[model samples]
Target: MLNVDGLKNGIVIDHIQAGMGIKIFNYLELDKVNGSVALIMKVSSKKMEKKDIIKIENVVDINFDMLGLMDPNITVNIIEDDKIKEKIKLSLPKKVENLIKCKNPRCITSIEKYIPHKFYLVDEEKSEYRCEYCDEAYKLEF
Candidate 1:
């Protein structure tokens, strides 16, 4: 019976994969923001059976590309005056720069710290991304 007050004007990130809410919270640096942020983890869901939710009490620019990489199934709900203004469904980004590192030791990005880690969406249905440099493949569960 956990009850959280609704946001007056902000954004709600819903349908986060279980156990990933903390990662998203840190990635968004919500703790550094001077606003109320509510993170509810492992909540029961009809679609997912278990999921995580984040409620931000103020409008903030969110990196949709990072969100897409982390979890494409996530849904973003824009709220204003305690009502949902819009619903945005996240999808895998065509390219990600500096967000995810190439694990291949031989990759130039691995040696060159200045080079931004770049990955391209190679498989949408499987949520697979490949490093632009070494052709290293990364698969993420959606």
Candidate 2:
């Protein structure tokens, strides 16, 4: 095992799917942070064969909903005073708006351009999201 410096306060995002770690890193603007940031990819996991972890030092606020869309299985640890303060289990959002553009050609968002793409969760089990304007169904897939 490698020794990692403990952070005073920040976030530790674990359980990221191996290659998708960088995707979330960019999505969350973690790479652009001036504070300490560490991204570990393809680390050993007991539950998962492989996983990725991201550590941000001195970060106070983070958008968890976007993180969930980037990778649904991610685990978040709130670090305080070099200790694990809290553990957050992320879940797919009930609804997503303007995050994903409707791919359908005839979709209202595509035609209107100005109107934001909005979707409502229709099925949590099936991960189905339906567009309010065009009725286009989008499956929430990472």
Candidate topping lDDT: 1
State the C-alpha lDDT per candidate: 0.93, 0.84
**Residues 27-113, model 1: lDDT tens digits:** 999998889999999999999999999999889999999998888889999999888999999988999998888999999997999
Model 2, global lDDT: 0.84
Which pairs in model 1 have colliding backbones? none
**Which one is best on TM-score?**
1
Clashes of 1: 0
lDDT of 2 at 132: 82
Which portions of model 1 miss their true places by more than 4 Å?
none
Model 2, TM vs. native: 0.86
Off by over 4 Å in 2: none
For candidate 2, write residues 40-70 as lDDT tens digits. 8899999899999989988657778778777
